[model samples]
Target: MGIDSTEFWIAVLQIIAIDIVLGGDNAVVIALACRRLPKEQRNRVIFWGVFGAIAIRITLIFFALSLLAMPYLKIVGAVLLLWIGVKLLQPEPEGQGHEIAASTSLIAAIKTIIIADAVMSLDNVIAIAGAAKDSMGLVVFGLVVSVPIIVWGSKLVLRLMERFPLVIIVGAGLLGWIAGGMTVTDVITREWVNDNASYLRWVMPVCMAVTVVSIGKWMAARARIKPAAMIDLADNANK
Candidate 1:
C-alpha cells in the first residue's frame, strides 16, 4: 500500500525499533571477530564488515518483499516474528569467544568481515524482510540507516541495557505487535478478519505481545531454576 511521508516515517521507526532489538548481536560479533587483529586491521575489518552486512541485509530484504507476494508466506513470517519477539525478551546466553587475531592486508580484513557477517546474519535478514513487507524503499532506507546503529551503537545499547533492561522487553513486545499486524494482513488471516471485521486488528497484536512476554518469563524462570536445582543436588551429595 502507498503511504505518505508520515506513514512512511512511522514505518521506518518501527523498522528501526525492530532492528535495535534484534541487531545487538551484530555489534558483538563484529567486535569479537576483529578483536584479535592489530589495531589498524581491526578498524578496517569492522568498517568493511558492517558495510557488507548492510549490503547483504538489503538484498535479503528485497528478496523477502518479493517472496511475500506468494500466498501463506505472510502467515509463516508472522509466526516467525512471534518466535523472534519471544527470543528477544529472553536473556542473551553467554557466547563463546571467537576472537581471531587481526590481519595485515585490507583484502584480508574485508574478507574476514564479509565472511563473519554472512555466517551471522540469517535472522537479521529474515526479520528485516518481514518488517519491511513489499516496500522496497522502506527496506532500503531502514537498512542504510540501521547499519551505523548496528556497528557504532554497541556502546549505546550496552549502556542502555545496563541502565534499563526493560527497554529491551518493550522492544520485544513491539516485535510481537508487528508480527500480529503482519498476521492480520496475511491473505488468509485478512479474509478471516474481514469476515469477523469488528475487533481483531487491535486484539490480535495485544494477544501476541502478551503471549510472547508470558512465555518468555516462564522460560526465563525455568532456566534460572534448573541450575539452582542442580546446585542443590550437588550440595546434598556433599552433605
Candidate 2:
C-alpha cells in the first residue's frame, strides 16, 4: 500500500489504533521487567525489548490467526504470565543487586520483555494483520510509527512505578487479568465455557487478577522481611 492511497491511510490508522488499544499490557511488561535496571541500561533494555517484540510480531502476523486457536497454547501462556507477574513482584534477593553483572541483568530483562510480549501479543498480531491485510508495507510502517509510542509509554509507566510502587501490583494484576481472559477463550475451553459457564469469560479474569495480586503481594512482603530476620539471627549468634 502506497502512502498516497486512501486505503493505505485507513489501514495505517487501524493498525495504530489496534496497537494503542492492545499494547498497553506490553508496555507494562516492559516497564516491570526493566524496573530494576540501572538508569543507563533502562533505555537499552526498552529499545531492544521493543525491537525484539516487533520482530516477533512481524513473524507472528503470518500465523496469528491459527496460533491462538491451538489447544493448550493460551493455557501455557497464562501459566507463564502468572509466573512472570509473581517474579516481577518478588523482591530481588537481598544483596544480589550489585553482585549480578550488568550484561546479565540487561540480557535477562530483555529476555523477559521479549518472551512476555511474544506470548501476550496474540490479539495484537492478529489485529494488525487484519488491518494491514496483504500490504507488508502498511504493517511495517504502522509498527515503526508505534515504536516511539510504545517506548514513551514504557518510560511513563516506569516513572509511575518509581513514584508509586503500587503500580507494580497493578501491572501484575493486569497480566493476570489478561491471562485469565486468554485461558477461557482458548479453543479447547471456549465451547464448554460457552455452553455451560458463559459467565466465566468475565469471572475468570477478575478472579485471576485478584489471585495474582494477593499472591504477589504476600510473597513480596515475605521477601522484604527476610533480611531483617537474617540480621537478627546474626546478632543472636554473636551474643
Candidate 3:
C-alpha cells in the first residue's frame, strides 16, 4: 500500500494504536530492568534493549502472521491473551522491585529487557498481525514510528501508572477486549460468529473488558484482605 492511499494510512493508524496500547507494558519492563544500572550506562542498556525488542518484535510479527493463517490458532492466541490480561491485573509480587534492583550489570539488564520484551510481546505480535493484515510494509513502518515512544516513553508511562493506577486496569481491559475480538474473528470460528452471533463482534469485547476489570478488582480486594487477616492474627497472638 502506498503512503498516499487511504487504506495504507488507515492500516498505519491501526498499527500505531496497537503499538501504543501494547507497548506500555514493554516500556515498563525496560525501565524496571534498566533501573539497576549505573546512571551513565542506563541509557545504553535501554537503547540496546529497545533495539533488541524491535528486532524480535519484527521477527515475531512475521511468524505470527503465518501462524495465524492456520485454523484455530487465533482461538489459542486469544485464550493466551486473556490469560495475560488477567495476569496484568494482578498486583506485582512484593520484593519484585528488589529482584530487579539486584541485577546491577548492564549486560544483565539488557538481557532482561530483551527476554521480557520477547515474552510480553505475544499479544502485541498477534494484535499487530491482525491490524497489518499481512502487510509487512505497514507493520515495519508502524513499529519504526513507535520505536521512539517505546524507548523514551517509559518514564512518562511509569509516572502515569504510579499516579493513576487505573491506567493499568484500563490497559488490562484493553487486552481482554482485543482477546475477545481476536477470538471471534479467527478463521475457524469466523463464519459461525458472523452468522449466528454477529453482534458478538462488538459485544464480546465489552463483556471481556467487564470480566477482566471485575475479576482484577476482586483479586486486588482479596490480596488486601489477606494482609489484614495476617496482621489481625499477629495482634491476637501478641495480646
Candidate 4:
C-alpha cells in the first residue's frame, strides 16, 4: 500500500489505536522491570527491551494473522478480547508485587524487560493483527509510531490515566467494540452476519461498549462496597 493512499492511512490509524489501547500493560512491565536498574543503564535496558519487543511483535502479528484466517479462530479471539476489556475495567489487583530483583547489570535488566514485554504483549499482538488485517506495512508503520509513545511518553499516558480514569473506561469500551467487530467478521459467520444481522455491524459494537462499561462499573462498585463493609464489621467488633 502506498503511503499516500487513504486505505493505508486508515489502517495505520487503526493499528495505532489498538496499540495505544492495549499497550498500557507493556509500558507498566517495562517500567517495573527497569526500575531496579542503575540510572545509567536504565535507558539502555529500555531501548534494547523495546527493540526486542518490536521484533517479536512483528513476527507475532504475521503469525496471528495466519492463525486468525481459520474459520472459528476470530470468534475465539473476539471472546478473549471481550474478556480482556472487562478485566481492564476492573481495578488492578492489590499487592501483586513483582519479584524482579534490583540489578545494576545492563544485560539482566534488558532480559527482564524483554521477557516481561513478550509475556505482556499477547493481547497487543492479537489486537494489532486484527486491525492490520493483511497489511504488513500498516502493522509495521503503526508499531513504529506507537513504540516511541510507549517508550518515551509512558509517563504522560500514565498520568492521563490517573487524572482521568474515564480514559480507561473508554479504552475498555473500545476493546469491546473491537471484539464485537471481530466476532461478526469471522469467516464461518460472515455470510450469515451480513445477511441476517447486517445492522450488527454497527449496533453490536455500540452494544458491546455499553455492556462493558455498565458491567465493569457495577463490578467496581461492588468491590468498593465489600471492602468498606469489611472495615465496618471490623470496627463494630472492636467496639
Candidate 5:
C-alpha cells in the first residue's frame, strides 16, 4: 500500500520510539563491554560496536518485514509492540559502571554489543515492522538514518534524559501511538473497521493509544519512585 505523508510521519515516529526503547539495553551492553578498554581505545570500541549493531539491526529488520507478512502475524506483532511499550515503563536495575581492564579486546567488545543488541531488539524489530507494514524501503531507510543519530546522539540524549525526563515520557507516548496503529491494522480489527466505517476507523487507534500511554505513564511514575525510595533508605541510614 502506498503511504501518505501522515502515514510516513507516523511510521518515522514509531521507528524512533522503537529505537529509543530498545536502544538503552544495547547502550548498557556497549558501555560495560567497552569500559575495559583504555580511554583512547574506548571511543574506537564504541564506534566499531555501534557500526556492527547498525548492520545487524538492518539485517534483522528485513527478517522482521518478512515475518510480518505472514498471515495473522500483524496481530501478534501488535500485541508484542504493546507489551514492549508497557515494558519500557518498568524499572531497570542500576549497576556500577564497568571499569577499564587492560585485557579487554576490541573483538570481545563488539561481540558483547552484537549479541546483546540481537537479544534486546526483538521488540524493536517486531514493533517497527508492524508499524511500517510492507514498506521494506522505509524500514531500511529508518534504521540507516537512526543508527548514527543513536551513536552520536548518546551524550546529548543522556543529558536530556537527566535534565528533562519528559523526553522519555514523550517517547513512550509515541510508542503508544505506534501500538494504536498496530492494533487497528490487525486482521480482525480491519474487518470490523470496514464494517463500522465511522466508529472503528478512528476510535480503535485513538483508544489503543490512550490506553497504552495512560498505563505507561503510570508505570513510569512507579519506576521513578524506586530511586527515591532507595535514596530515602540511604538517608535514614546516615541519620
Candidate 6:
C-alpha cells in the first residue's frame, strides 16, 4: 500500500477509470439541478454539492470495503458489477429525458445535487471500492483527482462516448474484468479457487466480459424489436 508500489498506482488508475466511465450522468444531473440558479450561484452549488457527494460516496465505499470482507458479499458485488456493465453497454432509447427538478435556492440546489449523486453513484461506489482494494489513501487520491474530470471534462467524455462508443464498451469490459477477479477472490470461494482452480483468475475476465456484451446486445435487440413491432401494429390499424 506504499505510494511507491506498482499495486498502489494500479489501484489509483482503476479508481479514476471508474470515475471517468460512470461520471457523465452525474455531471448532467448537476447541470440540470442548477439550471434554475443564478449564474453566480450555480458554481457554488456545484462545488458544495460535489463536495458533499464525494464525502458520502467515500463513506459508502468504506462500508462496501468492509462488507466485501464478509463471506458472500463479494460474490453479490460481482453479480451487481456484471449487471452494471451490461447496462452500460446497452444504448439508451431515443427521446429519453431526465426528469430532474431545477432549483432556485442555493441550499435546495446543493441538496438536489447530493441526492442525485447518491442515487446515481451506487454502481460507482462498488466499482471504486473494488478498485481501492481497501486502501483509503488510494480511494481519496483517485476521487480527488477525478473531481475536475467530472466537473470540467464532462462534455468531452460525453462526446467521446457518443462518437466512438467503443470507449463505453471498453469501460464495461473493464468492470466485468474486475468482477471476474472479485468472484474468485471472495472469502467463501477464495481458498478453494486458489487451491483447486488457479486458472480461473485469468479466465473469468474474458468469460464475464463476453457474457456482459452478449447479454447487453441481446437486450438491445429485443428493445429495438418491441418498438418496431409497435410501429407495425399501428400501421395495420391505419390500413
lDDT of each: 0.71, 0.68, 0.73, 0.73, 0.67, 0.77
Pairs that clash in candidate 5: 36-101
Can you give the TM-score per candidate against the true fold?
0.76, 0.57, 0.77, 0.78, 0.75, 0.78
Two-way TM-score contest, 2 vs 6, winner = 6
Error of 4 at 47 (Å): 2.0
For residues 35-96, what per-residue lDDT tens digits would candidate 1 score against the true structure? 66789878877887787777777667767777766778877877877787777666644333
Find the 10 residues in a row with the least total lDDT in model 6. Answer: 225-234
Winner of 1 and 2 under TM-score: 1
Candidate 6 regions off by >4 Å? 1-12, 36-38, 96-112, 224-239
In candidate 6 the C-alpha lDDT for residue 82 amounts to 93
Which pairs of residues have clashing backbones in candidate 3?
none
What is every candidate's alpha-carbon RMSD to the true fold?
6.3, 9.0, 5.7, 5.7, 4.9, 5.7
lDDT of 2 by residue, 165-235 (tens): 77667656766676777778777998999999999987987988888889988988876856444544377
TM-score of 4: 0.78
lDDT of 4 by residue, 97-146 (tens): 34646655767767777776776576777777666655777667766766
lDDT of 3 by residue, 1-239 (tens): 67798967766776665566567678878888778778879887877778777787877877897898788988887777677667777776543223443567876777678678888666677766655656778767767866776877777766877898877787677667767777788888889988998999979878887887788778766665355333343775786
Candidates 3 and 4, the one with greater TM-score: 4
By descending TM-score, how would the candidates be arranged? 6, 4, 3, 1, 5, 2
lDDT of 5: 0.67
Per-residue accuracy of model 6 over 151-212 as CA lDDT, tens digit each: 77667778878898888777787788778878888898889989999999879877987888
- Of 1 and 4, the candidate ahead on TM-score is 4
Count clashing residue pairs in model 5: 1
- What clash pairs does model 4 have? none
Predicted structure 6: lDDT: 0.77
